[model samples]
Target: MPIDHKQPYDESNIFARILRGELPAKTVFESEHALAFHDISPAAAVHVLVIPKGAYVSWDDFSANASDAEIAGFVRAVGETARIVGAEPGGYRLLANTGKRAGQEVPHLHVHLFGGQPLGPMLAR
Candidate 1:
């Protein structure tokens, strides 16, 4: 079930645990403001998740509170992660599920980078 984005940031969230070094992640890239790692349940050939270093419930929270430098670092980390995972140059897709309606299973903010194969349509409908 998706969690509400407005809810308090859960320190025990999976991503938070991963960040705290309490849980293992297949790290792909890491920077001062972000960390990128391979998704355990990949939706595509190249499904990596890029998340900010700070505790944020979702994109809305991150954008509203994160500093410009933090935001830039996070964005740059995403791009660097894509390049390292071979999802740039050719093509790739970035997806961020912000709210319950968007199927945000995890409360922590994260961007999904998918590529390595032709992703048919943006939506199945």
Candidate 2:
């Protein structure tokens, strides 16, 4: 499934619900610009998600609409979350799936922090 970047942001999306406090999340970090939480279906031992508070559907949307401060803050939050989760030092992978073809299930723009074990190759043969 390929994501249509032109489509409007879905407020009904699960991440949006979590941001609105309508859904529960195991939050790890929160700031004025971003929120970090554990992924319900983690792919790695330490899988966490860092998302901006603003309504942005993808990386393109975020880079285009979000302010510089928002971008910086969000990235910083991701790093901080990685450190808190013990994904730093040893190593970690920060990933953002822009479209459905990239396996982006949620519409909201988010960064996934994966670590705690060797991630291996980025893609399979």
Best by lDDT: 1
> With candidate 1 superimposed using the best TM-score fit, by how many Å does residue 54's alpha carbon deviate from the native?
0.2
lDDT of 1 by residue, 44-101 (tens): 9999999999999999999999999999999999999999999898799999999989
Instruction: List the global CA lDDT of all models.
Output: 0.96, 0.92
Model 2: residue 54 alpha-carbon error in angstroms:
0.3
Off by over 4 Å in 1: none
Poorest stretch of ten by lDDT in candidate 2: 1-10
Alpha-carbon runs more than 4 Å astray in model 2: none
RMSD of each: 0.6, 1.2
Residue 36 lDDT (model 1)? 96
The sequence of per-residue lDDT tens digits that candidate 2 reaches over residues 25-100 is: 9999999999999999999999999999999999989999999999999989998999999989889999998886
